[model samples]
Target: MDALHAWAWRPDGPAPAMADGPLSGFVLGVKDVIDVAGMPTRCGSPLTAPDPAAADAPAVARLRAAGAVIAGKTRCTEWALNDPAPTISPFDADRTPGGSSAGSAVAVATGGCTATLDTQTAGDVVRPAAYNGVVGLKPTAGWATTAGGRAVAPSIDTLGVLARHVRDAAAVAAAIADGPALFAPPGRAAAPRIGVLRDPFTDRVGDAVRACLARAVRAFSAAGADVHDVSTGVDLAAVHAAHRVITFAECASLHRRRYRDHAERYGPRARELIERGLGTPARDLQEAGAVRRDAAERLGSLLEGLDALLVPAVPEPAPPRATTGDSRLQIPWTLCGLPSLALPAGTAGPLPLGVQLVAARNAEPELIAAAAWCERVLGS
Candidate 1:
């Protein structure tokens, strides 16, 4: 089968034999920022000309050891920031399949590979998965090591998985974390209590997205889930602004020099962010960190008794290719560092809308369980 052309680099010969393990039959794609031994970790930039990685990144090695075939390096936004990749959405060629995890999402959506490794410092993973109508899970921060992936807001960046099924996403996550293969256990005692966040963030979503989310909630409720409208009381705009400051500051720290010397080589969006980072004060970043902590605590409190938070993954269906789509709906959750899983809820126009189920930190199993139930409900 022909793998999606989302690859930035591919192996010359046949991939190493799929070693015997839980992931033996799976073919996986690695995002460009992730090191895959002999492949170059390009980070989708012309400026940061890097050499081939000497060894696979820890996460990649873990999957390789688990018997997943290395498909190739997928495209990403420049430096995993605002820049867009060349990938067009399989559902609608005129629109973008969000980034910087665009290629990975496209790969899975088009059946190019079983799954792909993706990273999210902001909304990279979820937005792309939503645009492509696939499953994307961003595990709790630090669950998967970032040992060899190109750095992008180290404090918030998280390695995740993109697949067509929630179970496939969970399996890859478990393999990478070296945890139990809890893809989706059968028959939990009762239905999950899912919280639906009704805040300014979700309010910003268009009618189409809201309709889609409403349908998913109805499906969950019908399937015995106890769905409630909840609030974290955290200001959405403030969280998004703080995330910007933190992201820019950390990103600047990692690429300031290269950015200074190779300004022309960087994309316009990348250059704009690097400049913003360079100009940002230490006080701003520290303040943003405080906000992040408070937001995380507030979010945790909101999920206190609920199994997960059901919300719109993106504010609207995939927009025109001029931009990668908004991350407003996803930014707050990302900053909170909660485990979030995005799954296709329904269609909005010709494009698809996704609903995200978020649980407290390290509660991936709970997230998967609820997502599995919702997936079945939507299918029915």
Candidate 2:
């Protein structure tokens, strides 16, 4: 924050003075999960209090090297869980801004910052971006490592970005991904083959969301893309169950002694989640891991010959300030560790709605290419 404050505080920064050279010269909001050397990483918890970090997360380092200014840490769900923060909606302060990447999305949406870093275990990145009508891209798992910061569900956790447009998202993603996927491509054919998931995945999404999805499909099809719905026969209920087991187990291990020994200091939701994780039987956790591995493999098989799997990123739009929006719409894909992007489709009353673009595991470059093309066609 000092750097951002310094920039905002003095005439040396771009906001106060013109840039001396060519660069994007944009300001960026870094998610709390990512370390920006010398900045405190509260991760939205009272106990895990703020302290300066020793190094800039690789993502931050690259952006700075490219001349982007760090805009300070944004509010997040405590420990990146369901606990809500004080960041009220910019659209309607009475509503939730969505979390755990809440502030990052709002920062971009409200034009307080040009871009922001975000992370997702389940829906942290996409849901918030959807709620705020911005673009969020979660590249393939492991494409960007979580080396310098906290981890809630390491297996599914990914470093993502929130920006106003697909091009900005792509540029930032390139700066942070496994080197830009060798040459970026525009969309494929006249009819970009998109598979809309059937059954379990689509069934859970709410009515308004379904309507928005249909609009998105029509937009793409009208733009010359083949938008078709298909069923992969993947049992998402089973996938969700397995996901909960693995994520909680991993979260529990991360918070093990802190949860038990420093019980009072932990946030209510995170504390309870950790306790529950400890109680889960070892056999159940083992079974969950096995299930997840099988699911990731099967997901690839199911996505064969497809460009992207289109679905709702969240079940509904942002809910009341009482809690964050739903995470179910994202849980299963996270379990499979596939890349997903949440693009704002339209509005649901005062809140924003989103669509997800899923691709086979590790095929992020292609997924992003398709998304950029979709954004162009939809004019999103």
Leading candidate by TM-score: 1
TM-score between model 2 and native: 0.91
Off by over 4 Å in 1: 1-4, 181-189
lDDT of 1 by residue, 191-284 (tens): 8899888887677788998888888888788888998898878887899999999998889889888877888988889889889998999889
What do the candidate models score in CA lDDT, each in turn?
Answer: 0.85, 0.77
Residue 113 C-alpha lDDT in model 2: 76
Worst 10 residues of 1 by lDDT: 181-190
lDDT of 2 at 312: 88
